[model samples]
Target: MTDFIKKLEKEFDTQIIRSNKHIWENYYDVDNDGNITTLYLDEIDLRDIDILLPIAHSLVNLAVLDCNIRTLITLKSFTRLEVLSLRQNNLYGSPLEHLSYLKKLKKLDLRGTNLTDTSSLGTLNSLEMLFIGGNDHLDEIKGLEDLKSLYHLDVSNSCINSIENICANENIRILNLKGTNLKKITHLEKFPNLESLNLDGTLVEKIEGLETSKNLKELFISTWRIKRIEGLENLTKLEVLDLYLNEISKIEGLDNLTNLKWLSLNSNKIAKVENLENLTNLELLLLEANEPITYFDTAFFHNLVSECYIYMRDMIDIEEIQAAAPKNVKINYDDDYRWPTSLYRAPREVFE
Candidate 1:
């Protein structure tokens, strides 16, 4: 009960709301324009803000500990707020109940919580990044249809059975649906704009509607079974393709994808190098964990062969790279950005 907080109490007492002792530790300051603003605090704990129902609108930036706060009561008062992260909290009750008031907000991280219903999400249309993943209890997510501005939608491991209804959202460039029991996906026609589609551990055996998705760049399709590269010949915009553990291996139809910079074909059975003779833009090629790659002659791939990366930390030598490269051309190899795990072992060959 400090003199300053006492003065704040007389001006803000909605049903005798009490202030937590944690609020006193915050350092308050005023700007040149006389607008009151709290710059920083050693610790951020907002379990006691209900007392000042009127000042909630003044909290332009509030980031609380994910544990202490369960359900936000007067969050709508944060009309001036922009950035908020409620990660690692219970977040019970109507998940989108209190956040609708933050119209000026930019980002919202509700990852790994018990938020079941996401029906009120469309109201916050200005949001750019929506991290609503790891909520196993969540079964319904219908309100995102109006989020025409959302760039990233990470609904990974959220128990979502069907997102066929949400396919029309064109603004989403990155859509991650990893580790779900989804066996089939229909009508990707709705998302003619999807750049990155990750179906790593699902039962998607075939890629059906991707003939129209020319903008698709990075594609991670592992687990389950995809036997052929039949439908993706027209994917000229493809940059990275990760087909780690599958059966069929003739990648002929993909010759049209000249923009392909990275290719990952590990843990499969492929005898030939296919028709990549025209893929001059290729940079990094991951062909480990498949059949014995000790046979790919480097001279065949020298036209565009930059750096041949095999089994995560190792680079195929110039002689080894020249096995797949052209004899007339010569280039250095550098294993830059890395994938931590690969079905193939690094030391089996060479690592530097």
Candidate 2:
């Protein structure tokens, strides 16, 4: 470590030439080598390449800055960087022009940044996890036509009313769109590897085109206007389905989701739960704030014993439920027996 630090300092001195009061914003002593291993400055403006020119070949792994007035970043040559977070700053013209050089980047959080015209971002082929959730008015982000290595994308709060830009990224596993208004989505047939999707807040009237995915696991749509569950039967690998705060009265549409382990329907108009029988793998059912529960048959939900949550307003059907309940089933609204999400999944032995 000590020898490496000396090498880093010697490399830094030969590369960077300070300017504008020589105000070093920050520095790090990786191995106490009487020299700075990492350096940061305020006036290292990206508008000119002088600041970025020196650090590109140095051993810095992360670079984060705010070009409060700059229109672009001067980081076309920094290829070895691992992480970069440049958010909430202004990039009037565009900063993602030469981003393709960052092929080794793993996580890039660009939330709240004005990347409105970042048509250049489509070239960052190595970006694995990206967060553009805060750019609420970005109607379209063209050019990401070949980012096959991207895995996680968080566009939750963005105005990305469309998914047309990143449709072919087969490697994307997680997608979060928690607070965007999406009336309809097309071309989901290309996302075969998507695992988790969060559409919690939006006006999605229906989910008609999600059959192509084979490995989807978790889905969150708690605060949407959707009334029914559709386009999910083909996802035999689905495990968690959170549909809280909707108007779905009955579980009539989930007969084929036998692999689901956790299902929540709290704050809905549901009264009859007879349709829950086919969800044999289900262990948790959150039904609080629902209407009259006279149609609930314990036999239908008896298979959920190892972990379950069936709460509503009414007397307990302990006798009828006990007879059909699985021996491992445990229920509790008042105390310690309540099961966690981790326990909602049936054990390996149970599945065996």
Candidate 3:
């Protein structure tokens, strides 16, 4: 190593030793040519990044998570950086203007920051995965169509109410909008290649506007006020569905999902275990906490193509389940909680 790099290494080691952190070598990686390749300083309070500016050209992956960073001007020098994470920092007010200089940057994680604007990110054409969730002040995203190479994007738990800006990015594959202010979903036809979508903790009352997600395999709509399982007729390729903690009273609108493998309807208002006879390819089924549905239709077990796991509660009859279930099917009563407190009720027992 050169004298300058040797002196820089000594200073970095002293800082880590004084703070009682792990060995300095563990936080950074160097190439055989004495160039720094990776640096992980997550949760560290080091604020001065200019001290390492000499090796910016060699650094490829860098993470300074929760480091109280307030600026991004120094990071513009890292021209060779491909992945950068400044998650959970104090960065605010369009501080990402310098990031557009990183032409090679592909992935960025800016979660839980105090940013007010992110319009500058539209210039990152090479970006593939971008995470900007948990910024309450960020309400709108601009210039999404400019990111032709972008695929995975996350803006969950923010103030975003509309996604009109990203209606042109056809390459997007996975999108997460969980816990946002969105009450309805539109422009889904723009993402014909989407595979997974998370709308949990939103204000959407019904399942609609998903007619074009034909390739979707996984869908999550938990912890919301969705009343019925409709608008899923076009998702014939769906394999996993999680509707936990909703107001669904019936298990309809799933007949087209013949490829479903894992399904969870726990904590809903379901009153009947019907309409699932078509899901013969299911490998795991969860139906716990629906106290109203006191019985299981034994006919549903006969359609299983292979062994399946069924999550049940104590209120259901164990004798009926054991007799109705096929030899390969398995029953699970691991909900661990009893329902309807009564003085004459006896202690609970597990049936193997």
Best by lDDT: 3
Clashes of 2: 5
Clashing pairs in 2: 122-143, 122-144, 136-159, 305-328, 305-329
Candidate 2: tens digits of C-alpha lDDT, residues 1-352: 4344345447444234322222334233332443323443232334444444544565344433454535435565666666665655665456476666777776676767765654567777777777776775666655554777877777767776766654436677887777775667666666778888877776676766777767889877766466777777787888888888888866767878888888887777877767777787877777666676666677765555356645544435645655565655554444444423221221121000
Model 3 scores a TM of 0.84
| Reference-based lDDT, residue 210, model 2 | 78
Assess each prediction's global lDDT (C-alpha) against the native: 0.61, 0.62, 0.75
Per-residue lDDT for 1-352 in model 1, tens only?
Answer: 2344445535533122232221433333434554433322222344444653544545554444343456676676777766565655667763566788778776676867677777777788777767777888865567777877777777767777665744325777877777665677666667778888777777788866677677888887776498876577768888888778777566566768788877777666765565777677777666544554433444336567465443322233436554544543433333564443332221110000
What's the TM for model 1?
A: 0.72
Question: Which of candidates 1 and 3 is the stronger one according to TM-score?
Answer: 3
Top-TM-score structure, candidate number: 3
Q: Give me the displacement of residue 86 in model 3, in angstroms.
A: 0.6
TM-score of each: 0.72, 0.72, 0.84
The whole-model C-alpha lDDT of candidate 1 against the native structure comes to 0.61
- Selected candidate, larger TM-score, 2 vs 3: 3
Tell me how candidate 3 scores on lDDT: 0.75
